[model samples]
Target: MNLGLTPSVACVKPKPEDSFAISFAPLSVEDVYAKADDPANGAVVVMSGMVRNQTEGKPVVALEYQAYEPMAMQVFYQIAAEIRQKWSIVTRVVIYHRIGRLQVGEISVLVAVGCPHRSEAFEACRYAIDTLKHNAPIWKKEHWADGSSSWVSIGACETQGC
Candidate 1:
């Protein structure tokens, strides 16, 4: 947990009705944003991860995301707890990541956090997305316009569990 992430502790999958969530079916960022909105919480930060048209100057046609759902769901819950512990003002955290072929400009994932103030909301929101990218059980495969395909693991995992 040195990297400001939650320790990988065993926990039940976060419930559908819980503040922590992960959805595979394409869910709207606006919907997740609405769920995190609260008059009591002055700040609501939403992070949207989109499939870009290129990577490192290489033209990308699409990306396919696949994950071990059980493990990924566990990590997502752990991240939510970590955010709450680090920033007690955070009232809600919602994450939605898509698994399948995604075209350019399509949203690949979304993370939203509600907090009493802007600072905590921003910090916790960034932490959730960064940690998920670094530690989740998801894998991304890039499809190039030239018909080349490659599985790219996150840099943080490339030297470890990968």
Candidate 2:
């Protein structure tokens, strides 16, 4: 049976071992890792995206995140499906993203992949985050120390070295 939020994609049922969510509360690495943990897997690789203190040499105080929730959740399911297609040994996939203002050092996103081998786990986890960054309908505003703020596009990672 599928769990977590329902996928907006038609005819696509998310696996019971796979989970996705967009939350306003602070994300926890331990909780995300546990969600991806499985006895059938030897490795669970997790990638935690945190709000950092600086960006492009500018001091940052906090970040505000927003998402088109339905679409973002659909993209999360697509990412997990792609991972499973690429790594058949993958046992679980868990993705969580935070929305609202987040202070520096706070977790913003977490992507975890469980696989029987470390290599596949790492590769799948990397793929999940990269895909999410590029495809998810999520946006973030950087709150600068200078009392300024600006919305950053998803492609900002490519041009701004994020």
Candidate 3:
């Protein structure tokens, strides 16, 4: 019955350093990067979401973000767990999202992933941000230059490419 088979040893992965926060203050790329930094990491990829000056050709004056804090934080943790499952080599995951009114060019969110390789770090970082955008209980209000304001749906991001 044995066909030259050997019992595979179970690989034990180190506990990944994960940080998640729902903040009212501004998000800093350097801060998140530092959180995701690990001695075992060869690369740390960071994605920073910012308040753009325009949306769908409309001039945007500012954006106001709101979130269900408790649930959003839970979702952030879930995202990190998912990343670990998908990329076992991931050393750390850091996600920070800012709420409140923000002017154009301001940072809104930061997602960073540390891994032993550049490709996995980049992929894991991208997954964190994209999943957060769709799954987190967060909302945004866009203020137009014409003094009109509209609340945006999270689903709109998929269709309108927001």
Candidate 1 local Cα displacement, residue 46, angstroms: 0.3
Runs of candidate 1 with Cα error greater than 4 angstroms are 1-9, 12-24, 155-159
lDDT of 3 by residue, 129-155 (tens): 888888777889999999999998552
* The candidate that achieves the highest TM-score relative to the unseen native structure: 2
Each model's lDDT comes to 0.82, 0.88, 0.84
What are the per-model numbers of colliding residue pairs? 0, 0, 0
TM-score of each: 0.87, 0.88, 0.85
The deviation in Å at residue 64 for candidate 2 is 0.4
**Candidate 2 overall lDDT versus native:** 0.88
Which residue pairs show collisions in model 3? Answer: none
RMSD of 2: 6.4
Instruction: Point out the worst 10-residue segment of candidate 2 by lDDT.
Output: 153-162
Report RMSD (Å) for each prediction in the order shown: 5.1, 6.4, 10.7
- List the candidate numbers ranked by lDDT, top first: 2, 3, 1
The best candidate in terms of lDDT? 2
Looking at candidate 3, the ten consecutive residues that score lowest on lDDT are 6-15
Summarize candidate 1's per-residue lDDT along 11-96 as a digit string, tens digits.
Answer: 85553433544456676978989888877789999999999999999999999988877767787888888887799778888888
User: C-alpha displacement of 120 in model 1, angstroms?
Assistant: 0.6
